[model samples]
Target: MPLTDLRQYIEGLRSLGEIQEIDVPVSLDLELGAITRRCYENGAPAPLFKAFSDHPSGFRILGAPAGTSRQPGLYLSRVALSLGLPPNSSGLEIAEAMAASLDLPPVPPVVVDDAPCFENTTTGDDVDLTRLPVPLLHHGDGGRYLNTWGCIVARTPDGSWTNWSIARMMLVDSRRMSGIVAAEQHVGMVAQAWADIGKPMPFALALGVEPAIPFVCGMPLPAHVNESDRLGAFLGRAIETVRCRSVDLEAPASAEILIEGYLHLDEKVAEGPMGEFAGYVPVEPSMRRPVYRVTAMSHRNNAILPVVVAGEPVEENHTAWGIPTSAQILHDLRASGIPVTASWIPLEAALHWLVVTVPRDWRRRTGIEDSAALCQRIGKEVFTTKAGAVIPKVIVLNDDVDPTNTRELVWAFATRCHPLMGHATFEHIPAAPLLAYLRTSEKVASATGKVVYNCLPPDEWGEALPIRASFRHGYPPEIVDRVKRRWHEYGFH
Candidate 1:
């Protein structure tokens, strides 16, 4: 059965020994974020904190819900279980599953009258954003962030379409919070539609919803594409949603908390300097952005807030955004007639680079011998796809080098790719401004360019490829089989 909600996903984690409950007290300040960051860096189990020193009894915090796993057989266990996949599934398997689901028709979410999200509602002056134990993620962070992994639901002016997406939000006051919404994002476009009509856009912030919902929201789908349908396609069933108290948006029925608010066109507030997926906190000044004025607040009896400490690799941003983006890139490449077998966004690269692998004999099969031309074809197609907005660097690999394996990817780039001979550059393309390499001057420019690093040898040299002298390739099959069978007897474990 599909994991219906965040609580169900938590239960699934417990069953697989992937979660660790902490009865000890933890602060809602940087202490919580610090501990969470440490756990993420170490690949430790998800931390469920029962006692928030300042918050009430029912308030709970879950850290690193989708962080990568270090288990022997379940490296992507958290990502897999969140998407209703098996615990032992590989990264490639998960990406392929999501890519295949993109072809399935999106099943719209079912609207219901009553839901746990509406169990407790606060309207009018009673609304208070400070009531929740929002965490101060990093020392350099601007303020307490209320939404990291939460999904923000918004719609077009005529209600023709709805978009669900994840963005970071910081607490401003008891009645208002502010967040960064890029103009290119779906939510930003929807908000702009409302602003063009001279009105505040109604939005609902849903936290701890069904696990698959957040994963889908992080995807960069094309404009007018309903995220609900894509999420339905992911789970192979329609999701149940409940109407917001003060907004036109609908949130996951089983969501732990919901903050209904409006994006005021005239009202702006400073929001930023938070640790981003780029692995560095931007030193730029906080800018005036849309202020989310809280109109209503709702939550379950004993609600839990899921927090994603964004920094380094393997965090929710890397796992949720990077993985699905890779799948989208793969699909786009194949559709554009590029012979891509698999693709990946290495966590260590911090979501800036993408690795795609193709069969070594692809040139022979397609009769395309000009390596530079093939590289340009791939660069133009991928850099123009939906996933291209966030990815700045592309690395093409041969089939022998698995894109999913960081070591193999490094080896291929180090040994096969020549700096001048195998590289292609595309200029005047859109680039994500948050990338640390894009300085103030480059960001101000109309467009930024990207490089396509081809880490594959020339087609003519394929047959003369040097043999890999690794244990598996160098040793006899019988000897390797015997060693594997007696691995435990040899006291290796």
Candidate 2:
């Protein structure tokens, strides 16, 4: 069944031993952020803060709702459950399922008049953000952030398209919030269009919606495609949404909290210096960014706020956004005729390294250094053509090994990859400013942008002859069944 709400999703995590309850009083300051980061690094369960020092009754915070896990194959397991698939689904299976669903008809959203998110409404002078415990996530953070894991819904000036995306927002005051809107991002493009018209852009920030909402927001769907509709297609049912009290925008009906606001063209504030997903703080001083003025705040009684403290790997930044995004990119690339088998963005690379395994048949089809050329082409195409500029390194591997398994990838590199012959380079690809090498370096060169194609020879793409001969294709079915039936008796277990 589809996850109906945040609480149900949390319950599902609990069933899988993926959640921890913390009853002791915890500060919303840097302490909670540090604890969450440690949990992410260790692949531990999501933490439920039941006792906050200054939170309202029944107001709890959940951190890292979906993240990397200690158990093998659990990452894909959690993601599959989030998409209403079986728990034991593999990464390749998840990608194939998503790709198959792309051919299914789009499921339009069902617009309703009233919803639970509007249970309590605060507007104008009565809207006090300080009442809610907005966590000061990191030690070096400038201020409390409220929209790290939230989705911002905004419509175009012509009202032709509505964009849903995950953008970070820092609390500036009771009525104001500030965040960067990059021109390359869909939200930023829509915001700029409204700014050009000299009008405040209407926006609705949906917090703690169904787990699938944020996952869809992180996906790189084509332009003019509504993520809400894509979400419905994935769920195999229509999504329910309600109009905001103060704006024309609509939010998920099951959202725990909703903030209706406008992005003023003239209003700007100094934002940032917070630890970013790249695992480092911005070296440059905070700069002025677009300011969002909150005109109304609405929420269900005793709302549960989901917070994502972005910094290192395995956190919400990686598990909730990065890995799935890479999978989406792989789907797109393969659909566009690029031969991609599996993909992984390693957490150690700060979610920038994308390793894709390609089928050997593709290499044979395209002669002349197909692996190296394909790696360079993919890097440029994904980085410059789409929203994949956030990714930096691209590694191409053979289909024999799992791209998500670091040990397997390392083994392939050690045994097959030739340093100089396998390496490939590209230049002038627009990259995110937050890349560690780009942020800290004094002299940045073109060679900084590079991808490696660790290609195994055609003969080595398949398993060894002895191992292949031992499989079901080589063994008689009766003999194999007898061996399986007597395995426990032979003490194999």
Clash number by candidate, in order: 0, 0
Report the C-alpha lDDT of model 2 over 72-164, residue by residue, as the tens digit: 767655676778877777656766676666667889789888988788889998997777778999887888898888889999988788888
The TM-score between candidate 1 and the true structure equals 0.96
**Whole-model lDDT for model 2 versus the true structure?**
0.77
Which pairs of residues collide in model 2? none
**TM-score, every prediction:** 0.96, 0.89
Best by lDDT: 1
lDDT of 1 by residue, 272-365 (tens): 8889998887788787878999899999877889999999887999999999898888878887777889888898898888888888677776
For model 1, the stretches where C-alpha displacement exceeds 4 angstroms are: 365-367, 444-446, 462-464, 475-482, 486-491
Question: lDDT of candidate 1 vs native?
Answer: 0.85
Model 2 residue 434 lDDT? 61
* Error at 421, model 2, angstroms: 2.0
